[model samples]
Target: MPEGPSKTAEYVATFRAVESARPEGERLFSDPYAASFLDGKLRLGAALARNGMGQRLVCRYIDRNWPGSRPSAVIRTRLIDDAVTAAIEGGAEQLAILGAGYDTRGLRLPAAREIPVFELDQPPTQERKKQRLRARDGDLPSNVTYVPFDLLDEGVGAPLERAGFRTGLKSVYIWEGVLSYLTPEAVDQTLAWITASGAPGSRLVYTYVDVALLKQGGEDEPPWSSQVAKVGEPFRYGLDPAKMDAFLGDRGLKPVWDQSTLEAIAQHAVPGGRNAPGFYRVAEAEVLPDR
Candidate 1:
């Protein structure tokens, strides 16, 4: 946002991964290695918040202050994780994560362990992940490759190709928690590459804020936009819900799964959930095979 990898990206270190590291009853899932991405203070807080009200309190405060922040990220992470796992089981190969930031899926997911993991993000943030990863564990996974680049400045196809990404490989392209912060051109270019390069049956998963929420904002835009702006990251792009099916078709992709934060919570039986409309949406789209 301000410089390097987004300041907003750091929250993945705390909110999504770190908290998810708790025991199953406390967490929807766990990411033990995600603790490596967190700083000392975050580590301490997360440790104190490993279960019960302590954990709920942390998320409640964030949700109260910044609506849709915690629930969206948490549900989106779980959804992405499930999608990737299923794809791998179905014989997918290559894995690419755009704006990976502090995500630990490459390390933590069992299906991902044997596959080539290509992570793309800002140079500084990528380096920081490597440093923290090394400090936390000792060595990088042999299958993991880091591509240091900006999607706004450069298209993913070239850099990822240089990183040993093969064309027409059945792969999962993950652009988690990042689209709203990017320019429209960046979004289109990335999707173009994913749709064009993916082998038959490949798919992409990404999260986006609702366009209507930000467009006619009297209540939604003020707090959400300003809160993100305070961290030097502001919402720049969104997908229209009504046009999404056609939108995917235009890019040579087809919608496979779509979930709003409310739906995700309902699916997961998350308690005390608010049915907030115009919040966040996570969608998975399949790359239509070439005729």
Candidate 2:
């Protein structure tokens, strides 16, 4: 983990903040707590985004700097939000969010408020989020249990168990914007933990980049790659969307829903007016019963 909070997390929060600032009829989702996690110019920009004109200006500035990143993040957020809601409605008793930096789902989603939420991330980012939440809401939400641990050095099982995560419970895990930052070993370990620790019918909602993009071996890196690398959180893993079903099946998961970033944006965002990176994908999978 970086010495400070995750910059990418703050960037995603800024994306949600900007989206939430849109008029109620036009916004995809509302994350009222998202802006509180931002800093400096981003905080100012989110503040200004409360009006339609300000929203367009902030989006234009973000697009100029990050190309498809803002739209991709926004769309990804809404997709995951829908998946989580569906999971809750399907009887998920718990929610475990891996790399949960700056995410406000536990507080913002009413369905999430009905169950216990485990928010896991690096110590610095977890602390920063909690501090911001306390300042804004006077206390941490009673339903959220923050688990601060280094993803590189530790597996989630022990920490989560210590934090009162019950095994064999119907759970929903959100691995949003986190897989690309982990080593393959860490990723596999996490999957193993989720399958071993969660009961059948549990759900996992995650985002990953196309492995083909990572292995293409060209001078042209994806536009967002450089930015993450500059912040010391470079992408390290991706799954081929073509083989994702087989991959997850081998790991005891059944893929139920999958979509490319472009597809999600097209489905959820205003039509003919949005462009987002297509290499990023989101998937929802169900944990299979052990043989």
Candidate 3:
């Protein structure tokens, strides 16, 4: 992976999104603009992904090097997409993407016109993404705003307020492929902020890995945890799936849907693909009305 804040390892998720819609008949969600974020390199990965062996070779390298990122990237993208769209249809008025690294949903989704999107990340990644977006379209969509957020240094509530996030409008908050890199306490703080800040009936769509595997000698730690640690971005936050409901309830977020890898595979994995227990899961939660 690249050096900091989900650099090279982060881009892999984008590449895998492009791969999801290859060859024609076998496809998942279609993201034509996913390549624009890549500066054209994902097309190369798409070529490599054409055949079974080449695809396996590319994925194998990512697995050995990055550990367990592929499945969550693939599955969570689709699930979050669904959750966000559903939220919007159900009266969501804004989108807040936490750790939004090169994600093009705001640019590509038609509903982007229906609500403003706020992409929050570290400054460097956000700057680069802005430059790339400018080069491709001359300027960003008027409804799309870029916000710099250092999750370690701060949480979203303050930055989002500064960026004009409406506290009264229902919103869909997307926290994908990011919690594992955060400390558990920070995760709790962030979720607490979302629960307390978002309007009643707002929704949060997030992905988190299993906490047991992340702890010392837990039942299902992903083998990639060590490689990820070696790269200096070891996991600090995780949630035991069994306790996830209570965890969210405590934070004033109600679990609406939670999908394990087994369910994701049966529902969305490409036909007969071999994916290790990336154990990453996608969930949707509702902000409880103020009592």
lDDT of 2 by residue, 1-291 (tens): 467899999999999999899888888899999999999999999999898788888888888888888888888888899899999999999999999988889988999999999999999999899999999989999999999987676677999999999999999999999999998888988999999988899999999999876776457787688888889888878998889889999899999989988888776764222667788898899999972
Rank order (by lDDT, best first): 2, 1, 3
Ranking by TM-score: 2, 1, 3
Candidate with more favorable, higher lDDT: 1 or 2:
2
Best by TM-score: 2
Taken over the whole model, the C-alpha lDDT of each candidate is: 0.79, 0.89, 0.72
Model 2 TM-score relative to the real fold: 0.97
lDDT of 3 by residue, 152-251 (tens): 7656688888998877777889887788887767787888888777888999988887776666545444566765666676777788889977888888
lDDT of 1 by residue, 92-158 (tens): 8989999998888898899988799899998988998899888877888788899998888866799
Which one wins on lDDT?
2
Residue 266 lDDT, candidate 2, scale 0-100:
73
Q: Give each prediction's root-mean-square deviation over alpha carbons.
A: 2.0, 1.3, 3.1
